[model samples]
Target: MYSSRNMCLKWLLLLLIAVAGGAVAAASSAVRRDGGVTYDRRSLIIAGRRKLLFSGSIHYPRSTPDMWTSLIAKAKEGGLNTIDTYVFWNVHEPQPGQYDFSGRADIVRFIKEIQAQGLYTILRIGPFIQAEWTYGGLPFWLREVPGIVFRTDNEPYKFYMQNFTTKIVDLMKSEKLFASQGGPIVLSQIENEYQNVEKAFNEAGARYVLWAAKMAVGLNTGVPWVMCKQDDAPDPVINACNGRSCAETFVGPNSPNKPAIWTENWTHLYDLYGNATRIYKPEYIAYQVALFIAKLNGSFINYYMYHGGTNFGRTTSAFTLTSYYDPAPLDEYGLINEPLWGHLRELHAAVQNCSDTLLYGQQTNYSLGPLQRAYVYSGDERKCAAFLVNADRNNTDIKFQNRTYRLPAESISILPDCNIVSFNTAKVAAKCTERIRVPTMKFDSPMLWQEWREVIPVFDSTTLRSNLLLEQMNTTKDTSDYLWYTAEYEVPADAKAEIKIGSRGHVLRAYINGRLVGSAHGYFRNFSFTLDTTVLFHRGVNTISLLSIMVGMPDSGAYLESRAAGLVNVNVLGNQGSKNLTDKYPWGYQVGLVGERVQIYSMNGSSKVPWSKYTISPNQLTWYKAIFDAPGGSDPVAINLNSMRKGQVWINGQGIGRYWISFPKPDGMPSQTWLHIPRSFLKPRGNMLVLFEEEMGNPLGISIGTVYLKKLCNRYNSYPFLGFSSTRRS
Candidate 1:
């Protein structure tokens, strides 16, 4: 038997040991409260360690929800650690007080998907996202708001801005989406490239930026907030660089305490209507990346677009085509655009391998000669990395630290270790480039198109009268794009008459006595024109009707509200006398085509409507409907609209988009005629394609086709995910 004192002593010792073990376990399991996301002047600290983050922009609304996972996964496989996207205000709240977050607008689902893939997210909540979206991502209804001025220090604008921003923040907080709440979102962005046009707004713009920064900070989301392209961004709000190459030198008026982050590294330029596609070489992009990492000591870099998807509906602006195919790593169809994708993957890996050294090491740069330079990053005694760059057009041999490196023209050599070259921008690995081809298909059954005439309303006594020509936007309030102008004139026997009209409308069609006459449109802006047409008229009252159509609203300008459309003045000149009919005579007005009011786009909806088998020539307003079998398979379908003139298309009652082939070709835009159809929207049979041709072209040539892949080049490139491979360059 042990003594009582000895027993007590043994118990005390055991208790001390248990407490010590508990303390050790607690220390091992403790996690950082900020979800391990922090930043300093050098780099972003993730999981309590400094890291070099490579992010890519993939807008949620541009793609389907079903596509979010695959797109994000592909981005990950391509060596991206983060995904970025813009939150479209117009898409969420198309009408004030009414909100939508379902379908393609489900931004929360998109962020969750990114998180599920173990990736970070950067939410760009730009209420004024000028991503070629209609009205610059601002609700058209905002124009209707009383005493409202956008993107400035206006009280009404700020009130709505705060409301929307608060709603988003509250929703994000409730879902615990911020990094501080153990979610995937590590950063938030407010305002886009406002600095570009800030000078126009002047002092108000400066005040608005400060207010925006303060508002963003007040949201209390435990993640860093950024203001892209805003040079005057206040402290606590990081100012990010956006452009082709946002290297360290490009860091604008940003606070010195924040890490240098490139918000948008443009991989390719956005396509404009009537312009040919702009292609960015993969080799050059790789060189830019290597230079950014080596020369600029870049911490975090995000590609503007990893996947540039379709711009469905009326979302296209700046005269851009419906296809938002921005020649990115992933094509518009979501397939890997190889050589570019693989090459970038290799470059990402090379950078990631030296992430520690790049983030924490002391960087030293040396200029060997003109356009030839070397960068060395020394983390410690044993860990070091270097980059040998030759930016000249000719190949050069660079001697660095007793080693001669053959640098190719405008290329970069990445040495993960200071000793050997892991990858070179000039030495491309073999990879298959995907070329999209539209395959010809023979329909099992011939497509039959039913035609209908859009009845033009005649003037009646009930027609509203206005003395002065009214602006279309103010008069119709965007109710419709079409407007009618009518007047009466007495035509004397054998009298020659001409109608002189001054207008700012997009397209103008004049008709005398319900008969189609000549049509005229301004080359650029609205101008004065005289229409002379021979017509047999009695010595009594004659009817004159003119139709004006607007392509789209002006999205950018000062005092945009003052811009006017439609006939500003009208006069009739005859041998007998001249009449100023500006607002002297009663004018008849109509909002839209008859087919729009009747729902003629749908087969079931238009079953009661009479149809004609005969098709009309291009120029007159007409509706054409065709039924055909769906182009089967997983590949996306597109209708070649090259045969058709300017118009709008509907697929099974869903509006595809507006097409205007009549617009004059710009320098870079090619004559585009293909319109993409989402695979999810297609059915096996009884698929209908309805077109409301405003200005005509042949409808008989319209056909449906699937995009087929063709190998552009056979460049063998090794990816970390695909393992190492040795192959010859194409």
Candidate 2:
């Protein structure tokens, strides 16, 4: 492994390369500053004056429409003036030329709701957004487009990209959603994080960026355009920063005319499956924001997820948890995270109060020792603001303005009046609370089971032999996660043979002559593993059938768009004879599971399914359904999947997400036992709950539950008022 010093040096070299590249992109044109939304090096000028912006991201699809109003209101009350979101292309344009802007995919309505709440918006329209979404928010059908290449300067790719972007802009224009139209959206983004893989595309990547910038400019949306993480972003497109702390390394904007802005300061990493939940302390995150304002003069700061909602349906990419970001200030259910939420709200108000001075004031800096410094902003009429920082690990006192003040370790003190410490990153004065759960089976029922509409490959008598193993994504078009392939092995004499199937898998289950042989799944996305099990082979035409399942597809890397997702190869090893089956086909394949083809996940479509009332033992590749009434009242709801092994869940035809209760925890239990069920997806009666179990698990143990928080204590009330109460957010 490279040492920390080497890593730092590597980053320095990369930075130098980026700066040199930025200079080249700057030659085309300069950002047009004469507009309704302009920027100086220090601030974003809005309404004809420099303004400080506190923004938060709330992906509309992550939450239900019933939850949008409350979520937006919560963000606004948290002292945020702006809401940031990415338009999910896959969700919007499910099929070619078909649009779905209704329901949760409604970007216009989401924006109008932001406008209704008196907040601005930053709409990142990446037709190729890498938001840990399926296909990185790109429409899966685009892969089926003739002569198409995604995210680079391919003509075919550009056409659809421009088409979708123009569609969104036109829709917003029709609704008057741009700032130029006196709407909420003040900024627009095109293409996301292209620079990370630009090197792989070589010169074509560079050219593509230029074309994208020019195309975005041609749109004439009347708001500033942004290209996030693009150091070489073309002229007129403000290149922005995205990381944990912009202050640590942000040099400035790509050009002098553009204000340095942070597009996505991640609140915390999302839950990667199989890993325990991780957290970034409230004070720790606050310090990053405070340091950005104190040292970098960053006027616009947006949290990637101030409130991370659920990753409903099959939208989650790879093995990510259904709970998108559990460490966010707001939980997946949209409730406050207590101390963290409260602390940041306090920080927001403190910073907002000093906005005017920080925007127009003359800046001065002072160093009081190693990592101990002070920044003072002097504005009109002697009004001033200050930021006292202690970046060291130990508490220290510093004398500033001829007065001594104590600063905690790795903390920053924000003084809106320049003389008093109103907010400190190390302080958490909000009342503390702990969550309580009635996560019991409020409603439980014996579910009816059924065999798939079509026979499993092992049972098919008319199976044709094939040598070719098809790639998974290309065959399914991401419409379904399951693919079935059957291959024949001829054993001249009766013998014990080993059937080996190597797969580019999220999951793979193998069956030899109607007998369950073995199944294996990769813990990570696109993991390569083999399912090898020994079986007695009959002399004539023994059938080997394999089922490949994609838990989630790849969402990153330069060539993820073309990554294979199914059985790569298979072989039979026996003393009688050995042969490779992968070379045998003209492989025609089954598109997906019969249940999916029959649309069993939807209410109307499920009635057509043939169900058996007789109870069956827990088995692989099975379907089960139960009808139950919704829990009474409006509190948030969750379902306990502890009884089941692995499968996806759907309620009233709305998919919650896939669940794997078998992945062993330290206590030999599943990592996540209870999963969220949005209240909006629930109805008062006859809620249909469907499960497609891929492994042996008892469905009878499933139950309904409720999760709520109980206030524990308060300690800061007796202290003098340093800032407004952060709990006033509700």
Candidate 3:
């Protein structure tokens, strides 16, 4: 009797164990399926899960392949599960039909690095990405193509775009970087934020949008495609919102079967040209995020710049009226943007705690006030979550469900248990460092007494021996800033010494025997200026040298198509700047920099060029070479041209970047001083410097120094000033 009773108990225990095992398998299956989408809602479950997604945006060409690993690891530590990037077209193909993907242009290696970190990838392939990028990501070669207009259905434009897009897609496919192939990229974008400027394009714009969607769909990556800022995207494409408050931003009418997503939550504004503004505060950012999540039915949201990296070399875009890079959370030096980073991190953690309810459960809103609203999502009695958000900049306190919560000027509130407030936007206590890098006021050399020499005109009007007019962007193709428009003006036998020179606009420099007599640029209503060539013109075969510099081009507008660059409607005005001469005469036109065609810089690395002895009267056109060991280990090196004038700099033959020590802004500040030295733009052994100083200045005083964060400290309860935060005690 005892044996029979024990046998029955054992069988009962076995049955219970099998049931538990089956339940565990079912839960695991649900977690895996939650990541992707399906045709029917009944086939999928949204609630009862937690996700660990890491993300960062590192442009492939922004930094070299050597720097990719370290960058990816840094993102991982910052709690990123994904790496996001926009494929820049200009950097990929500067010249048409010439495909080069080696060195920093290696997008394949960039993704492989992200995959190496065991992280997912978000590929934002906007051939028209306006990340403050030059030419809006269109290659310079594209503009030169006959009858080709950008972002349209023009066959030439579409053909080129399709070619490059498919090339990149194929390259990634070969590397198996798409999720369907068991790789990193799970999301891809088409035509970034087009709806914002849709009216400008009209039907062609709508057709282009459809074309972009169809093209992307044709790639067949097995993952759903996304169209950011498109309120009317076609079916099967998930239209995502992009902006500071995308939570309330709606989906496109054409595609309604996908979940809502916030492609970009502007953590802070980008840097502007003038005085750099500080990023938004952490509490403010947190408040914004809370508001976005609470007000909208968003299933997923991504920061516009979770990590803003450096724009090394000429990678920075500056075509705007003034250079406004937009002071982002991360500065140009790639330093941590503290308080901002911390406050957001805390908010992310809080949101994560309730991810199950936020991602899966139904959202219900409660009106707290005129501008205040709250959202409650309950997965279970113990797993309920709540949020109170005030979008206004003014402070607001609301009473809800027998409890009162205070909302800061522009912030949010999070309640994990639904009944108790665990986090408040006005109450973030994270610490941050406040610091700035002061420009080197002085260098080792003197400010003045260094160099002076004039550029000899090798290709003057008589020297060229040809009469033609070259259009600025078209003929020269932006290879050089200066285009020589010269003609031999016959002075009347009974002539006054001065000749009145005039042009359609200003920005003309008069030169006789390569001497800079005078220079003029358009300032106000009048673009035409004067050049007193009283002694400039002579009898028989005289050369008139005009150096026209383009300040900035027409970036956008209907009139952009009509804007002209270089000397237009040029003529020499005589009789005390009255009578014009050589108005209709045939003029000789020569394109590009005098030094460029000569290969004066020798940019392709060979051997270190020798430095010439310091000249008492430095020649204006002569190139100067200086060698120095790369300013200690790993610290960024910069040359203080503050003492010198305008010139182009080359390190070990590679163009480090352009520098204008004296070209201060309208605000009376230098054009730019510090030249950031990236690890990729440097050489290990001996480093060389070559400068073509147009306006000769001090060369001996030019010194190379390192750029490092001056101070690293912590200030408590004030997060989100920059993009990072510190856990250090205040």
Candidate 4:
């Protein structure tokens, strides 16, 4: 009886043990299935724990695919754990119903490359990305959509925005790119800085933000969504702050429940055409980051452009220079910007050391003095971390917790143990300077040139019409930049006539009887100019042709379609009564320059076209071509357009960028003159350099050269601004 009772008890125990084992196995699977990222009020939680994320913005389209992996690896080595990028709508869907995702536009390949390096991604899928891109990254075709209003609660705009967003989200879903699908993408952004200008659209803007948040949440990507610079962002959409001093502002007023996330800590200012280079101090940037980590209870900080690559092609804003180098850690050529890069790396490391204490500890703040403060975070067992900040222009020593600490002006000091100072923003722990070695070509070896004439099309009575168009964009639809306004008027005798032209465009060149009269251009706005010249008008009729050129179309603002370009109105003041020729007489309109129609700059069908060996003066509109041996090796090339006036340069068949040497320099621009040319675009034997000189410039001074790293220098005087230097004659 005792043996039977013992056997029954053993079987019961065995059955209970089997059931517990199965239950444990099921819980493990459930945890694995719930893999993804989430955030609390304190920090971002990943794998069921808080994670410290340092991300950098490196737009995939800005740099080549071959450079993506190396750039990302460099970022990771610099202690970055995530890569942030914006999905450029203009590059992907250039035309309606057509898409291109190959080569530089292959965003999937870029994200996968980031994942391969074990780095997370912040997908800023803003269909309206305004990163100094042409038309602010909105497709040019959108202008044709009837009854369309951009970035507001408009049916047409919302329809297209939703379509594109859905398309992109579906693509990522198919590739399993979201974090929920065991992929690298952790955060997604919907709108970009919409709050700043939302008031312009009034009630529609508020409705648009709510609609966008709802639409983003509806996508169900299984990751938290962010609305950068949107203070009034609704629930489920995290409102992230932007700008240089984001830490000082925190996460704005409404979204206090969300974790503080700095979406864009501006490393440096963007370069504008005809402006001086803006240099930002590395120490200042370091201090900002350290202060942010010490003050804000957050886990993520992203640099606006850790690597501000080249604009390449016509992707740049109308007012922006060709080189999109924002004085970032990595320049346009993918070279390390020394102290800024290294110093920031050290700062990131120091912040990461105390991340745990910062995320989990209770925080206490104390005011040391005016513009000075101390913050302490204490965890379990009295383990503490501290941040000492001095925002004054002069250094100061302050006593905190019975210990004295010296803080540099406009700097922050991080104490991981609340005692030992592990890092200080003002100290130069890394290389403080960098020198660039640029290879100069022998001045004696001047490039030989061939010339071609751009035939100006004459508008006869047959093509003439009596109506001036409201704007160039509406008439030309952005197909060309040059527009000719030709009109004929009869004069009693040879008399002085004042040809008045009120133009909103950038440049205006006047011609009488096919002869150049005078030229005038505006600085930033439209201005009226009068040409008072003696004209030899024939008894029958005299021809007057006014050529108007647009630097770039209006890229932003409301009712951009209504903005006028070219001659708004023209008036002729002579011995007779002044006549208003604003859409009155037979005004002939020409779309583009004759050279563009013939593809003269591209060297296509050059064998059949007539060529001249004699060099012509740069006073008139002309096309200059030169055949020279390519600068050998893998070094990037740049043409010194120091002497060339305002125009465009083309290497082989690729258009480099627009050059405006005649434009007066804005304060802060360095005296340098070299336009960068990618090595991949050059050939070994024959390379064609074509210049469509508009105003006036000597092409003889043009030279080919290479750029290389020299040595480190102070942050205030980093290598002369990235684009063409103002110094003429190289």
Residue range 391-453, candidate 3, lDDT tens digits? 656777888888877766545678876877777876756555554444332334433222223
lDDT (tens digit, per residue) of candidate 4 on 1-730? 2367654654454344335443322322232336666666676666667778999999988888878988899999888999999999988998887998998899999999999999999999987878877777888788889998888989999999999999899999999999889899988999898987787887667768777877877787877788888886666577888887766665542544467788898887776655566665677677667767767775688998988887665567655676676478887767777777888888888878888888888988889878788888999877899888887777889998898888877777889999999888888666654435354542222337766766555558325355654466666666666888888788776766777777776678888888877787765433334444445555567788888887665566665435667778777777776778886566887778777767776767455458777354654677777777766666556677777777777888776777777765665332235666766667777877787888667777677787666655444443443211221110
Best by lDDT: 2
lDDT by residue (147-218, candidate 1, tens digit) is 988888889889998899888888889999988788988888887888887777766676677778777767
TM-score of model 3 vs. true structure: 0.80
Q: What is the alpha-carbon lDDT of model 2 when measured against the actual structure?
A: 0.78
Worst 10 residues of 1 by lDDT: 721-730
Cα displacement (angstroms), candidate 4, residue 274, comes to 3.0
Q: Rate the local accuracy (lDDT) of all candidates.
A: 0.73, 0.78, 0.59, 0.74
After the best TM-score superposition of candidate 4, give how far the Cα of residue 502 lies from its true spot, in angstroms.
Answer: 1.4
Q: On a 0 to 100 scale, what is the lDDT of residue 434 in model 2? A: 68
Error of model 1, residue 586, in angstroms: 3.4
Pitting candidate 2 against candidate 4, the one with the higher lDDT is: 2
- Pick out the ten consecutive residues of candidate 3 with the lowest summed lDDT: 37-46
